[model samples]
Target: MDHVDRTEIRPCRAADLPLLDRHLPTPGAPTRHADRFARQEAGTGTYLLAWRDGVPVGHGQVRWDGCAAPGVRAAVGECPEFNGLDVRAELRGQGIGTALIHAAEELTRERGGTALGLGVGHDNPRAAALYRRLGYGPVVAYTDRWSWTDPDGRTHEEADPCTFLVRDLTTPDA
Candidate 1:
């Protein structure tokens, strides 16, 4: 994929939901953008979107509440968690995902957070390697679990083993 020369990272807004739905639709549960935006409005977290040429290219969620996994919570006490980072399949490897991560880190620092945490599924070595390269270190291993409803109203659960990584924001390259 060609590198995006000028990707803009910003907080998601209600008006952007339509564009997101068209460009980055979450098929199973498509109201995600609205929900995350609502959470942002409530001061819970920020859902960031990466755009190139006015097209949504990537996104991520910075959870002020930290990881839901008990082990991660216990090990990375009070740390903000960066979750659900996704880049358009055709535009990956061009720094879009990295920019989204950097944006999330900046948001954390702006909120007076000293560190940030994220989970990489055990099966996803590529993502883990990216985090390591960006200064995150594995803190603990835990079951990454969550559930979501489909558009048809069927709920699904997931429980995957993963390693939670934390980065010290005291230093940008740490």
Candidate 2:
């Protein structure tokens, strides 16, 4: 189990908040991750970071909730055992997204999670391809709230902006 150089993924700490937020959903907006980091710090969730030469280049967060997306009912946020991977946009490719996801899955499995989950913008076909290539599969069709203060922090909780995904972390074989 040897990983590559130039970028290493690790568990996130309080001191890494600023670094994590840098590649997070929003630019120059710590408020975007305010709610998420608070819970992770409070022991309700976990955040993973991807670093290059001690510099934070990517980040992902895992939570014990379901359906974080918006406009979906009944199944959105239903299960409490699943985890989510909220990564940064700046490092979407270059293996950063996949590395961060693998790191988060490790942390989630260590935390007793059997299933891994995440949501991506419906229009982001590139992201969809990336996730699919990394072993993630779509379970349900859903959306996220687009606002001025969400992870991307624009200020509009628009409806159905993304798709829901859940991957089996146990079966590493496809």
Candidate 3:
């Protein structure tokens, strides 16, 4: 038997929130991890967190309804969108992101999504490259819409230039 080393990717739970917040903390803004976990607890969507030796290293979310990318919701209509993907800065290049993406794809497929969609910021070429390497192709160019609250509770909005990508999960190659 060939044994392979793999990071554990699992759904976020209430107890995981603090650790997730510590790992993915936004100093001046409200903790994004907590918000995602809250959404998970509320059943808004499924949020996945990656663990390595009991340490939180990566996170991603799957929204079955729509995506934040301006045209993605309209274009991919009804497909699950992988969102908020991030890995610890120190863990980059360790295949953590890839593992998280694969986990999300599997979950999407299990949920009956025939396609998976995502958006990568124009400024994040490395992530875009990884997405391309993993078989995601550009579907449309649009502004990614999102908002976050500052630590002081002030809400800040953002619209970033991004490219929406999608992969057909129905294909064996995907």
Instruction: Quantify all predictions' global Cα lDDT against the true fold.
Output: 0.89, 0.63, 0.81
Cα error, residue 130 of model 3, in Å, equals 0.5
Could you give candidate 3's per-residue lDDT for residues 37-72 as a string of tens digits?
777777767899889878888889988676855477
Model 1 error, position 63 (Å): 0.8
Whole-structure CA lDDT of model 2: 0.63
Q: Which stretches of candidate 3 lie over 4 Å from their true place?
A: 1-6
Candidate 1, residues 1-174, lDDT tens digits: the string is 456558989999888999999999997777788888888999889999999999999999999989878888788876999998999998878889888999899989888999999999999888988999999999999998777898788999979999999999998453
In the range 1-116, model 2's lDDT, one tens digit per residue, is: 33346788776666776665554446444464566668777876666667776777666667665455543335544433223344445555567777777777777677677777
Instruction: Give the local distance difference test score of model 1.
Output: 0.89
Q: Work out candidate 1's RMSD over C-alphas.
A: 1.8
TM-score of each: 0.94, 0.75, 0.90
Q: Give the clashing pairs for model 3.
A: none
Better of 1 and 2 by lDDT: 1
The residue pairs found clashing in candidate 2 are 66-77, 67-77, 146-156, 147-155, 147-156, 148-154, 148-155, 148-156
